[model samples]
Target: ARLFRSWKPQLALHAETSGKNAIVVTAAADLDGAVRDIVKSAFGHAGQKCSAASLAIVEASVYDDERFLERLADAVRSVRVGDSTDLDTTMGPLIAPASGNLLRAFTTLDDGESWLVEPNQIGDCLWTPGVKLGVQPNSWFHFAECFGPVLGLMRADDLEQAITLQNATLFGLTAGLQSLDPVEIARWTDRVEAGNLYVNRPITGAIVRRQPFGGWKRSVMGPAAKAGGPNYVLTMGRWTDSFPNCATSSTSEVDENAQFKEYATAWAEHFAVEHDPSGLAAESNVFRYVPLYRPVIVLVGEGANRDDVERCRLAAKVAGVTMIVSRDDEADLLERLLTIRPSKVRVLGTTSDAIYARCDELGIPVDDTPVTSVGRLELLHWTREQAVSETRHRYGNVRVRR
Candidate 1:
């Protein structure tokens, strides 16, 4: 968590919490499968997986039954712990001895009355119930990921409270619910903050081909869609190809980087020849020289000034590109947007020398074409490459002189 805060990693895909996360089990829906899921997600691999269930928010109706709680605890105890090399070992040790010490600290951090569940004394963890709940939403342990064999349990009065408890955290990677009512399941699916949701199933152990996995909010910084499925491949790269026309237009004589003075001439004589006039410089004074789907464009370092920023915005709109302006160059703004499945990301303007070098080092294509008044030509040429259609006959293959 400290590393992420200090370094601000460009691409952070959170499948779990940095603080404690919650698992909501309604009174009407407890089953053997739910208990098994709680055991697997809460204690599997020593609760080291990001998808592990860190907290349990059971309904008051079921939690009031002391017998149920004891049974659940016994199930947790059934999990075996030993050297991972032994195939029979169901749990493993912490990455290091220090990790065990840190988890020990978490147990005492909260004052709330709780039950201790230790599958392995090597790194025994804590579990707290929300019944008669007192902890605030901002509790660091309540929202931070433990990354160990620790799970918290809370009791909710009803379905709504359970959902509220589940959604309180900053992370929204995966969530599991057990219910027989179709309407209740629908409500849970529609409202749960998680990107990956499971009904009547465990939150962990998602198969690649079967379940596309990813998350929302701080849980994932990139596209919120699943990574294991079809959408996953779209993030790899983007391509564009539009050849320039041999014949020149009126603007061909002007400086490629200079601002335009004769919009009427350019519109009537050149752009309007093949493109629709209405779409090309509508009443908004916004221009659309080329057609790009939904490309993400990052404006590097405010780009000279406010006018420069406005210019990039106009150009992106005309080209159908989404623009994000930021001075921080260390962050991979493109990858963050790519998680949402943008067509492609186009980087414009200047950034730090390190960032430029890093982009080159990582093979992330960078377009440093100057955003001068004549930048429209460059934008047009760039958009040509983003053609997604089979037929390239929409416009002439006219290239702008760089």
Candidate 2:
């Protein structure tokens, strides 16, 4: 417990942390640099990392180039694999024996795909890096998570297509693009679905604050807060307007990093904002904030601080968090709380055995924390992702009049 407590602000839960991390190599990318970095990105840690670049969606111009193909294959073959304790070993054994995913990835060559650099399995848990060519779009291997030392290469007509192919996966964790064109980079950055994106660099090895790590789609679960981010502790405590409501438009002690400050301020504004992310002509995904379960009962204990109680009221009022504040006994307030079938009873100041007894009888959870408020922390309690999807087209026709 002490060890776990030491890791404060830990993102309490990370669900479905899987990936089909893909890389796009444009024709204008530095040939040697792309090969070197892509190899490192794909095969580093024996490709066991969640952010490992398992797929490379290369532009047709470069994909068909013999020079590019040969260099990429050679790089994979050259990586040293052996005992991890050996100073010369660059790649080591898998954490466990090979699973079905790894076995199929190493042995099987699906239709329209062939091994450019076939991996030689040293044993059940050890294998040299492998690279496949002619990996068809949406192939069995394309969207699958291998989590091993194997990389698949796919061909794309252009940058747009490359981004499309990269996103054609159940997981959107990480992605990389290698190109010299700023225009292509900008377009890729805007459309790529992964949480962490790298350009002209390896996709893994995310540094704290430099790249606040999280994922999109099924890549993330639970509270969906990025690890090591400003909102990392957002879900640890119940968001309450019960402390102090003093959020300003300007940054004071909000953040030392300009980027983080922007994130916090922008999030606070989300309550009033409805932004679109779908970018579809017909469908819209407006991210907006809504109130949590209503009639939240604020049980004010007799020993509660008067200042804290005022702070709580001011917070709730300012944030528009409506809750029934009552000086009723634990049993009385709990009855009201349970009658509404709402969340647990929230007590301020000091809670007594009667409160616990009531809660025990009601079979509801309870937590106690000092009354406090920060807009960034409290606003999240009232917000969640809500995507509204609509097909603008009806049966064989557009919904709107032309």
Candidate 3:
């Protein structure tokens, strides 16, 4: 945050990884695609690349199946780590011995920490894949970004949990989700916090013009300038005669239809009492909540009672974000998740073991309290507050307002 605030170059771009990227494989995901993408993303380039998938979050459905884990391990082991010039070499060495040492230091877990793949050293620059299990949101395995062939593997109870774990990092460089189901793909795309998002393809190897890579949060700044894209030049400096005006215009043409215009006017008037000009858009801090931004929030669950669903809807209203998707029937949950392209999804109500197992993924901290007993609004507020407090504690005096 300090770097973001202090640095002001012609075009400022910052990329930092505490340790590694995380990958998620859903139960409905194609095993072939999962294996292929995981290997290519995790160990590709000797896992020394910035975009390497350092953590693999596999759904319990597959993780519980020892055979599948074995298959993944075998594929990882098959990767030949040696000299880049060697024809048989599948993985390459670190840039320097310091890099290897740094990788080892970042990956070395403390007592009681889960170790999915024991840290096995083959050479100073080359090492076997390191996998760590039971990674908490605050765990170094989940937060640190290591540059090496070492990868952490954790089993999530469901897809949502997997996604939650995947997104826990402050870094949002690249994230990959493997699932054959279209709904899962849509939901993952919407929820995962990464500048470069990959659905079946490998997370790394983004094409210059095609992918247009950039990061969010601590990962980057500016317009997420794509290296090979047409806008890549924009980062170099203004190509136009006048300094470019990049502010987004909220202005839109008023509707000409009489009925629509009248309806809009009436709607505005009906809620006039709730409107506040000095909250988000305005400068006064008198505590009026007229939110200028309304983010999309998705609610994924099954067996949600009427009250639980209503509470979630009410929370969305209070928060000024649209509740794009809500599911109580497990059968159609995935379909609903796919249809609604939500950016921030909240788990609401009591969901099936399988449903939670599949879609309740986020890398942020988890609140396992039942929705019926504890309202979704309460949970959301608590999580946000916790995050804010933690951020403030870590980087003192960082101003954050909701």
Q: Distance from true position, residue 154, model 3, in Å? A: 1.8
TM-score of each: 0.56, 0.62, 0.56
Indicate the TM-score of model 2: 0.62
Q: Tell me which residue pairs clash in candidate 2.
A: 242-312, 243-372
Against the reference, the lDDT scores of all candidates come to 0.51, 0.68, 0.53
**Candidate 1 accuracy as TM-score:** 0.56
Question: What CA root-mean-square deviation does each model show from the true structure?
Answer: 15.0, 13.4, 18.9
Q: What digit string (tens of lDDT, one per residue) describes model 2 on residues 1-402?
A: 222222432223335378899989999887787898889988899999998999999999999899899988888888999999999999998988877988898899999999999999787778999999989998889988899899999999999899999988977788888886768866886677766667766788865544557776567654555665455675565554432223321432222243234335645575556544445554332333434444446677767765545444444454465666779865676567667744445566676666655554453334355544354554443333332222233234544411
Report the Cα lDDT for residue 292, model 2. 40
Question: What would the per-residue lDDT of candidate 1 be over residues 192-229, giving only the tens digit for each residue?
Answer: 77655666556677555444455544564333335554
Candidate 3 lDDT tens digits, 12-45? 3333333357778889877866887888887787
Candidates by lDDT, descending order: 2, 3, 1
- Candidates 2 and 3 compared: the better one by TM-score is 2
